[model samples]
Target chain A: DAGVTQSPTHLIKTRGQQVTLRCSPKSGHDTVSWYQQALGQGPQFIFQYYEEEERQRGNFPDRFSGHQFPNYSSELNVNALLLGDSALYLCASSFGVIRLGQFFGPGTRLTVL
Target chain B: AQTVTQSQPEMSVQEAETVTLSCTYDTSESDYYLFWYKQPPSRQMILVIRQEAYKQQNATENRFSVNFQKAAKSFSLKISDSQLGDAAMYFCAYRRRNAGGTSYGKLTFGQGTILTVHP
Candidate 1:
C-alpha cells in the first residue's frame, strides 16, 4: 500500500502570495493531519481533519487553513505567506477510531521569499 | 497544554556501539502515547518505536528500544549495535488520549535529537 503522498515536493513563493499544498492519505486511512517543520527543528502541529471537517487546530494563525476531500485527500493553504512560513510541510495519516500508528509522507518544502 | 523536550541536540556513536537519546514531556493526563520518529536527509518522517503511557514495561524493537519512565515523564531511546544508516534526526512526540471523543490525532513534538553513527 502506498503511504501518504504529497505533491509539489518543493515550492518558492513571494511574501503575501498564497500557496496550496496537497496530500493523499495512506490507503484505507481517514484522518489527515498537517505539520510545519522548520529548519533544524521538529514538526509543529498545524491542524487535523476528519470526516471532511476540522477537528483540532494548533497555535497557528488564521493564515493557515486546510480542507479534507471525500477521497481522503487534503489540502493545506497558507494566505499572505511570511518568511517565517518557510518550512517543510509534512502530512500524516492515520485511522480515527483505531488509534493506529501514523504514516507520514515526504513533505512539501515551502520557501517564502 | 502539553510540551515535549529533547535535551540532547546532537549525539554521536561509533558503529556497532550503543547510544541513548533522552526525551521528557510535561502533561497532567495519565493516559497518552509517545513516539520516536527518524527523519533523514530525505525529510520523510519514519516511525521508529512507540510506548503507551499505561504500560510499565519498556517497548523494544529489534535493535531499537525505549526507556519509558511514566512517573518522571521521561522517555529515552536506546539504539544498540548502531549502524551508519542510523544517522538521522530523531523526534519525540506526544499525543493525548481522546477523552472527549474528539480524536483529532494531533501530535506535539519536541525540538529533536540529531544522531550521527560513525562507521
Candidate 2:
C-alpha cells in the first residue's frame, strides 16, 4: 500500500541545462500526472500519461515532456530550463482516467540557477 | 478558461476553534468536481474533501466539510475543532467531468490560503 513516490527529493540545475525527475505511482494505479508548484503559488498542471502515451497536456511548452513506463512509473523532463523553472514538481496517480481524486507524492524541488 | 480564486492568502485560528477558508471558481461546463487539498510544511499534498457539482448535498470528511454553491460558483471549506496539525496551505482545485475520449485529469488550482492554528 505504498503511496506515490518521487525520486531526487531535490535538484539544482542551471539555465539551458536539462533535468529529469522520476515518480512511481502507488500500487494498483495506472495513470500518472505531473504538476509544477512555484513558490507561494498553487500547482499548475503539466501533463498526464496513460498506458505509456501522453493523454492530455496543459499550457506548458514543448520543452516540458513526460513518459510513462509499462509499470506505470513516470519521468518528467525539462529541457533548456530557465530560472523561472525552479519550483516543486509533483506527481499524482489515480486508478483510472475518469477518476477525479488523485494521490500525490512528496514532490521533487527543482532549483534553476 | 476555468479559474479558481482564494482571496484569503493567510488566516489563523485558535486551537480547538473553527475556521472557514473561502474559494470561488468560474467554469462554463456544468458538470465538474471541486477539491480541497492540504499541503503541510513537509510539502505533501493531501486531499481534504471533494464535492461533485451534480450532488446537492455537501461533501464532508470527518471534521472537514465543504459549502458548495453551484450557481454562485463558490466552494468553501469549514474545519471544526481545528488542531495544530491543521495548520497548512489549503488549495482549492477544479476539474471537468470526463465525458469521453482522452481523460487528462487536469486540475486548475487557486492561489491557496495558508491556515495557521494557534495553540
Candidate 3:
C-alpha cells in the first residue's frame, strides 16, 4: 500500500515570501496532519484536515493555514515567511479521526534565505 | 495544553548494548496516548512504540519497550540489543483521545533525543 507522500523534496525562499507545501495521505487513509520540525528539534504541530475542512490547529500565527481536498490530499500555506520558518515539514496520515497510529511521510526541507 | 520534554539531547551506546531515552509530559486529560518515533537522516518519522494511558501495563514491541509511570507522567524508551540501524533521533509524542466533536489527531512532541550507536 502507498504511504504518505509530500511534494518538493526541498524549497528555498527569502524573508516575507510565501510558500506552499503539498501532502497526500496514505492510500486508505483520510485524515492528514502537518508538522514543522526545526533543525535539531522535534516536529511541531501545525494543523490537521479532514472531510475537506480544517479540523484543528496549533498555536501558530494567522499566516499559517491549510486545506484538505476531496481526495484526502492536503496543502499547507505560509504567508510572510520569516527566516525562522525554515524547517522540515512533515505530513502524517491515519485511517480515522481517532486512529491510534499515524504514518508519516518524507518531509519537505524548507530553507529560508 | 500538553507538553512533552526530552531532557537528553544526545546519547550514545555500543552496538550490542542498550540505552534509554527519557521523556516527560504534562497533561490534565486522563485519556491520551504516548508514542516514540524514530527519525533517521532520511527525515521520515517512524513509530517505534506507543502506550495508551488507561492501560496500566507498559507497552512493548520486540526489543523496544516503554517504562510508563503514569503518576509521575514519565515515559522512557529502552532499546535493547541496540544495532547500528537503531541510531537515529528519537522523539516522544502525545495525543489526546478525543471522544467527539472535531476529534483532531494532533501530536504534541518533545524536543527530541539523538541516539548514536557505535560499533
Please give the fraction of native interface contacts (Cα pairs under 8 Å between A and B) kept by each candidate: 0.62, 0.61, 0.65
Tens-digit lDDT track for model 2 on A1-113?
89999999999999999999999999998889999999999999999998999988999999999999999999999999999999999999987544358889999999999
TM-score of each: 0.97, 0.97, 0.96
Docking class of 3: medium
Residue B43, model 1: lDDT of 94
Query: On lDDT, who's better, 1 or 3?
Result: 1
Task: Please report, in order, the local distance difference test score of every candidate based on alpha carbons.
Answer: 0.92, 0.93, 0.91
Q: Write the per-residue lDDT of candidate 1 for residues A1-113, one digit (tens) a residue.
A: 88899999999999999999999999998899999999999899999999999989999999999999999899999999999999999999988542456889999999999
Compare candidates 2 and 3 on DockQ and give the better one. Answer: 3
User: Model 1: which residue pairs collide?
Assistant: none
lDDT of 2 by residue, B55-118 (tens): 9999989999999999999999999999999999999999998886234578899999999999
Instruction: Tell me, by DockQ, which candidate is best.
Output: 1
Off by over 4 Å in 3: A97-99, B100-103
Tell me how candidate 2 scores on lDDT: 0.93
- For all predictions, the C-alpha RMSD in Å is 1.3, 1.4, 1.5
